[model samples]
Target: MFHNFLVTTEHRDFLRFLWHEDNDISKPLIDYHMNVHVFGNSPSPAVATYGLRKAVEKAETDVQDFIYRNFYVDDGLISCRTSEEAVDLLVRTQRILHDNGKLRLHKFSSNNREVLDSFPQSELAKDLCNLDLCNDTLPMHRSLGLSWDIETDRFTFCTCKDKKPFTRRGILSVINGLYDPLGFAVPVVLKGKLLMKEILSSTNSLDWDDPVPELFKKPWDVWVQSLTELEQVCIPRQYSDHSYTDSNVRLVHVFCDASKDAIGAVAYLQLFRPAGPEPTLSFLLGKGKLAPNGGSTIPRMELCAAVLGVEVADIIKEQLGIPSECFRFYTDSQIVLGYLTNTTRRFYVYVSNRVKRIHSASSPRQWTHVATEQNPADLATRSVSATQLSNSMWLTGPPCEILTKTLPEPLSCFPLVEPQNDCEIRPEVTCIKVQMDDVKPVNHKIGSERFLRFSTWESLVRGIKILKQFIYTFLKQSDIDSSEAY
Candidate 1:
């Protein structure tokens, strides 16, 4: 529930609205002028919604908090732990939206029948009933372009790929249409992004419907074919929807890694059941990005991956309402691990900034190393078929038994390279002054000069004369010896 419920009409008055309709040869003409801020043009929806948010924040505290956290544009969405709380929120939220800001919340659907009981039948969604109740199931409910099967409690994807002409712009449109906010499709979607990057980096700019270049033909076809298999994929909608009757310990495992092509991170929830001897897991969310055309080193990209991992962990903590201390960060990069653990060495600007972000999000001690072979984020950085992703341990989380045990040794022993200080060290310098009249000249050879204020030419001449005499004596002795021997 959002609009310009805050913006004054005076502020909206300055904008002009105009249109015209005229016949060619001396016929009638009509011109229309818009009266009440009807301009809809914008690069961002913020222009329309931000004003209402500000007004609500200024007056209604509860409404502001809920809308700020849950609302997008005119739609206000939220979840509740219990049916009572949901009904209360629904009533209070409607009152706030109408009273505080002239907004009406509608198109509401909920899995809990009790929550939707108070609403008029006409106002509710046509097919919002429980599917488990009968063999005939309702179609999937949609929000933010992703489909949710309320009956099954799962996030389902519907893959509909028609044989359309493939081009850079078409690829971009399709990639943009993939509403994977949770990044379950990151491994599959990243391939398309790489192709787009390749096209943009090329010498020619391609049209929206132009044929895919010969260069990208094979990879593009393989990726598009894999897209068809995405219909089979279904990730658990909730990280921990079921009761953990047997398990008390819960941990969040976030993995980070980077390849030459890209960098990525993924967060997963591990539910340990000591009695069962095998804990269960659920995929939470993940993130990925292609290497910029400008390029970066693998170590730098690894550091970026760690930063991404920390961000994902922080978001998961906030969304799941989990304790920060329980979060653990994993990465395959030794350099990143060392950077987080090393307190003695300093890093260059790029590494230092990213390391700072990682530390601020989670403690360095929380960051641990996982073997490259075991890192799930590798699937995202490198392309994978949809089949691989659907069957991959990456989406399902690692087998809980093996992933929880055998953690790596601490990274303190593997510190980063010691940083060198560039500024040079200089010896201390002193100046001394003497009066020429009171100074005494020093007598010394040039090679072994005396430390004095001044030296006279006479001392230098005497030293040279002594050296010449020693050389003459040695030569005369050698000639006499030779004559005696003959």
Candidate 2:
């Protein structure tokens, strides 16, 4: 159609005007023209000229009318023999009118004059003309718009203005638009084969489930293996150096405490050979129950308990055969250690003094900190229900039978003695025995003294009468009469 129109003599002048040059056209348009008409090297001059002339005449005569009539149809359909011919005519006419400023308009109307007036100004009109020419080269049917469907195996295109039959070229164009810029430009006929190859290649080359191929043999793995080897080799040697022989009885005494909230604490003491565990005899000091006043602050209580523990250890060393210089102490209380070692703030002078004494006495003993979790003494300090306490005792090594039975009673054979006058009495007393039972024979002699023992009702009455007469005689000698007192 374009070739035939171009060859017609009468349309030659119109074509020149459409190209926007009486003398020369833009390089792009000239290239477009050369490619379509001459570069393909087809020997069909008459066919090309005839097509071009007809296209020009149709564009000049009725391009607007044809577009208006077909704008609403599926694919913007028209009665023209071919869509290509219609597009060519529309492009040529728009180009001519736009360059001459004849197509510039502000509105569209049925009247020819109104339609002409609606054409844009010169520059904008030229842009619209170029768009129309481009559209002519890639003529889009209104019905051939793009559609994507993941479920379908094939691409589909339908008219943009109305639903209509699909076209192969339309679908190809749509697919190209979708994938071309993403670098997949395989022709549609071969797209399925390419897709299948991609899928198979990925599946064959890589195992999705075993994604991390290097983790099993990576640097981290190698480092861990090296560490394990080092630990296995070194730990025994270290232990051997510190181990005790009968001739060199090294002692590692551990002190620990448990609390209800935080886990527990342990302290260690190391003694040299020949000295035996008795040198680390800090543990021999009797344990004291923590005062019931500060239950809420476990850390504070643990700290205080640790201070007491160290004090006890120090006293045991001095009083027992333990040499303070040979002892090495360990504790879970960082706070107590901090104060003792001057590592933290000190608040209690008494505790600090006790710590100093322990430090001075135990020349070989060094105080070290351990995490509460590793502290075994934790079991002793924390309150446990009877059952839990019983279970814990079983776990700890001891006179193993103590786990099954209660703690053994300490020896207390002497008769019950009244608190001496010089001694101040404590507010409460806890003793296993009181004076309610049968009187045991007393071995010690007493100086001459009046003594009353009430064994029955008659003896108790007689004793009261005798005590009342004595009190009456004493009062009369001191002063007032009995008659006035009653």
Candidate 3:
């Protein structure tokens, strides 16, 4: 087959020299002494030869050793391309030699077919065969790769030469199939893809469709439905105007208590007048001790505190010339409430008697219990920080300092009221002196007098009145004081 090609005259002469030793053309011809030799010269020989020579030169020593070690036969007399191929050929040649009686064949008995049949066939057997074909055809099938054979129940992968696989189901399908027998409903890839696409499409359109507006409308519709249902049920309209002849009639009552741990404890004396805003009067009765001093127990302290608060209200009623019957005391404490409400308890009996005495002395009053949340004075009974105490004081009344600032020059000349105790009176004297210094002299004379003549006791009395008036005015300005402060 090689001899039909045209050759140079010198190459023809060399070929004649090579053929002289070989009469039969079937034997592969080789010559050690030949000077001219060309490699891979059938077609595009130059490129092929150059590539092959480069590959061979670049091959590692270990690879060359492996090829020589595995393929060597008869101490390098014969060689083969691979160890497996050489082994197979050796076995075949030996078998032929044995059959000719040049060598003896070793005989072994096979196991029974029934025994072999007892073992189950592996599921991978068909897959292995399919894998072999897939590997063989991969180079040709570029656009359309072979798919896994579902009918054969084989789990195999396919590859393409250039283009990506088209017909082949991915690893997800194989996993789904394997899990199917285990009763798990693994999601189908096609179905999952479709669902994902649908979700993506919806998400893409969300902005354009104004989904937020639609979402808002749903809640609005629900609200409308709820309102409609509410409308179906009859509800009485709130009366804007209510009439009452006696504004002095009190309705709400309060009682309060405190312990040594609670120093600035206060309670409310709420008087719910029919024709006026509820009169919420707050009174601070010192509660909780700084140190253990022989004093009333928590309950007794509470009762005493309640009494002190009531006494304050009475004093206010007298000082302001308001009727006592117009006030109603409120308390959350059951003990205090019992003392005021219960006629049977000895202490309550005493309280009732005292109340009767007050009523006889002045006018009748009411007392009642209130839920703690509604009782504003509950805050005072609890332990409070300085800030909280200041805030509560501001809410209840004007601070003494603020009152001093707001008072008229004539009113500012008055001395602060002092307790009867000498120890308590000394602090008042100091505070009054400081306040007197703070008061600036008025330039204008009143009624031809350079300054108003004032006695110390009279000044103290007037100072108390001015402070009380300032408290009322400040309370009127604040939201927490309620409209009753007027």
Model 1: per-residue Cα lDDT over 1-486, one tens digit each: 223333455554344434344645455555443333344645226754775575466545556777787777666666667789777777777776667656666667776666666677655676753333334454678867788776676777876566655776667776776788989889988888887787767726656667776887787777777787887788766566544443578788888888888988998887776566555688889899998766587888888888888888878877667788888777877667777787655556777788789888888777777777788898898868788887886797765554666354565655654324211112234668843432433322232334242376787667667767876777677765532332
Steric overlap count per candidate: 1, 51, 10
TM-score of 2: 0.24
Answer with 1 or 3, whichever has the higher lDDT: 1
The whole-model lDDT of each prediction reads 0.70, 0.36, 0.35
Give all TM-scores, in the order shown. Answer: 0.73, 0.24, 0.24
Sorted by TM-score (best first), the order is 1, 2, 3
C-alpha displacement of 236 in model 3, angstroms? 37
Best by lDDT: 1
Candidate 1 local lDDT, residue 345: 51
Show the colliding residue pairs in model 1: 1-74
| Residue-wise C-alpha lDDT for candidate 3, range 78-168, written one tens digit per residue | 2334445444444444344344323321221011222212223332223232433323332211111222233232222232223211111
Better of 1 and 2 by lDDT: 1
